[model samples]
Structures are given as C-alpha cells and as structure tokens.
Target: MNIVDFSKEEFQNQQIEASHLEEILKDFRRDGYVIFKDIFSKDYINELNADFIDKYGHLFSEEYKKNVFRVGHRRIQVSVELKKSFNTPYLYANPFILPVLEGIFNTEFIISDLTCVTSLPGAKYMPLHRDGAIFKGVALAPLLPAYAVGLLIPLIPFTKLNGPTRYWPGSHRSPLHSGAFEGNPNFIEPEIETGSCILMDYRIVHCGNPNQSDEKRPLLYCNYSLPWYFDSSNFRFDPHLIVDDNNYSDIPEEYKSLFQRRNMKLQ
Candidate 1:
C-alpha cells in the first residue's frame, strides 16, 4: 500500500509498533516514499495552523511579503520562525517520524530545512524536480543511498481539489530527471489528512497539483540529511532554514545537534 495506516497500530511510548516497521521501510525503500496516516492529532494540527496563520496567513500582507519566496505561479514558500509553536518538539522531533528515519539512514540524521510551501487558489502545477541532488556530476548519483529526505506535514487536509502532491513511484532509483515524468501514467496523488505526514527520498520526481479549490494549502516541509550532507538547491532566495538562539536552546538535548548550523547572531 502507498499509505500506511498507523492510526490502528499499537504504540509503545508513542512510537509505532515494532511489527509495522518492516512494512514501512519496505514501502519507503521500494517506492522512495511513504505516507503515515494519523501521525498527529487533529487538535495539534489545528494549533499549528493557527500559529502559522498568525504569522503568515495574509500572504500578500506588507509585513510577510518580504519573507515569501515565489516558488511557482501562485505558490509561495515561506521560512518558518523557529520560536513558540513552530519550534515545539512535537512538530519537529516527532516520535512516529524519527524511528523510520533512523532505519533508513541507520545512522544519525540532522534536520536541514523547515519551511512552509503554500499553494494559493489558482496555483499551477510545479515543474517535476528533486529537492536536492544526491551527488551532482557523479555517474553513480542515482545508485547511491539516500543522502536526504523530505518530511511534509500539511496544516490542512490535502484534497483532490486542493494542491496534493503527485509522485512517480520508485523514481528515486532511476536516472530520470525532472522532465522524465511528463505523460507518465504511473503516478499517485494520495489525499492526505491533516495529521498524516508524507516521507519522500530527496531524489524522487514529484510535483504539486494545481489548487482548483478556493482555500489555500500550506504544507510544512522539513528536510533531514546525513550529518555530512547539505542542500545547495531550492533556496536561492531564502536560507536553508531559520532557528533563532532562543529556539535553538529550547530544543531537547538529544535533538540539539539537528540544528548545528544555528548561530547565536541569527535572527
């Protein structure tokens, strides 16, 4: 199955049951992506949405226009401030997410990016692209193991009329580039609930579907990578992420290393 329904699974200390780990990994490794349903509660998602609205609800407002990056025709990616509700561990170091990531890397991983990509009404489909290249100019780039992955949490439910993401299954292992997926019949755009989160390899070919509905669709995008890796693409206008000194200090000791790039002077 493309989506793993974790809502019915048993949980020990808020982590998925051990029995489901194999299936989750299998789907991820084979398809280069997987979706976990019911990763968070609706109340939690509502709170996150509220927090995001407080800061960036008005997309064209004078205060936040400077913080917005025009990613597509009507789609904008805004860097989230790592303070208050945005910096909470429940959102970043989620229990249901970290274990699956650990299995994929089999080593320590660090969070490299945190931003929200909002698709406004009339937002068009994006050019199929990978968030980060594994090893540019290398012949064996596609064959290499995943060096980075993206964790997407939607603040609102992703609907068919809204801008749900479309993915080409198992594309991460192929030598295909962004242009390879056009006219490809094999694609899936799973309608995800607010609490569910999608995990995808960095090399996968995917794009956002147009938002035919009137409501805006905002997705919290988080990238995690091997400690040695850094993303050199997709942030030409903005920095990789934002985390102030106070927020960095608020992170749990175990996850502090994930924000190693944060410096005291950063605003």
Candidate 2:
C-alpha cells in the first residue's frame, strides 16, 4: 500500500522512459511547469470517454451542468470521477505517464484524483489562481509536500479557438496578488494537441480560457501526489473499487502507489 516499497529496477526503468525527465524537473523547479506531447493515444482517450459515460452518467445531467459557471459568463464544469476511475489500468498504469511523473516528482507518488473538464461553448473564464490554494484552510499542508502536479490530458485539441489553458510561466515563485492580471503581459497560452499532456505546478498562476468554438473542449485532468497530501475530491465516492482487481496490477507501480495512498487515507 505504501509507495516507498516499489522496486528500484522498476523505478529506474520509469526514469529511462522519461528521457527528458531531467528537463521537465528543471522546468518545474525553475518555471513551475512542463508539457509532454501525445502522452495518450486516441484509442486510450476513447476508452476513457466511454468508461466515464457508462460509470458516471449523472454527472452530465442538466442539474449539475446548470450549476457550473464562469466569472465573465455562464460556464459548465463536467463531473469528475476521481476515486471511481482511479482503479482503471489505462489511466493509472500508462507506461509513458508514470515514468514522466517519476522524473518530475522524484519520489514515491500516487494517483490522488481526476477531473473530466468539458468546457461547453460560451463557457466563461476561470479566475487566475493556484491549485495549491485549495488546501490553504486544511491542516494537512504541513504534513504534505508543497508541490502537487496536475497532468492535463486533452481529449480534444486545445487551440486558441477552444480556449486552452493560459499561465504566466515561472510565476509560481511569487505571492498571489489581486492585481496580477492587470495589464500584465507575461501570460502565455499553451496550445495542446489532442492526446498531449501538460504537467503543471500547483502554485503557478493559471486559468481556463473561454471556449469560443461551437464545440465543447473536453479534457481529462489527473492529479498525482506524494502520500501525505490531501485530495480535493471526496475519495469515498471514487469509482475505482468497482473495477476488477486484475486491472489494478496492470497499472504502473507509481500509480498503484498513488491509488493505495488515497484509499488508505480515506479509510
């Protein structure tokens, strides 16, 4: 159940697969962000989408969709099945993803939670904020590491027309300021192709852009973390338990650690 128990050879192989692992670590350490292109395949995305619809249909209901809003206009936030889907091997056990995470976090990690974000047409903009801020009120901050990374996997190509995520690179080192976005010119848009993944530092100042296109911008966001951190999702409702146990072992050891830690903490 503990991540620290993973074999050394397995961990080393993960590093080898993530050949650019050092570069990503450098980016995160210095700029607080990095991107990995085409981490998932089209077939993988399709499978996840089908699984989501089958297991959590209520999340796409009218009521849930109605409550999601953006700062400037109406917005839609799709249902996230963090715990329920965590046990899926395709998600947590991907060879490419686990190694990349290993390079970035450089520690025993776990799959904390995931969110399926579907930005409907006309969705409003999200305010600039850091993901770590979500844990500010919780007493678990000291027990956990300061960094929590979000792996943003776009199910559809994230282009300027679709309101892709934007961030001020290296801004994570600064304190959050109310006027940070006031005429500031450092922000840059990250254009991600379908199947590409972006690894972002939780402290980086970022926001979801509004989708101008007629089509919805769907994305899968998976969060990985060290064992002691707190999860924003209610782990008790996670759908991972419904999956067969054989599927669990197929996932990479790194992800297995993440899944185990979250389950242990919630239990």
Provide the TM-score for each candidate, comma-separated.
0.91, 0.72
Task: Write down the RMSD of all candidates, one decimal each.
Answer: 2.6, 7.1
lDDT of 2: 0.61
What 10-residue stretch in candidate 2 is worst by lDDT? Answer: 1-10
Off by over 4 Å in 2: 1-19, 53-90, 134-146, 232-255, 261-267
Model 2: per-residue Cα lDDT at residue 116: 66
- Clashing residue pairs in candidate 2 are 83-238, 83-239, 84-238, 84-239, 84-240, 93-251, 93-252, 110-258, 111-258
Candidate 1: tens digits of C-alpha lDDT, residues 1-267: 478776443544586777788889888999999988887889988888898888878875557656667878778887777877778778778888888898899988888778889888888899888777865557788878888999999999999999799999898888867687899989999898888989999889999999999888999998888978766556544556688777777888988888875532222
Tell me model 1's lDDT, rounded to 2 decimals.
Answer: 0.82
Q: What TM-score does model 1 achieve against the real structure?
A: 0.91
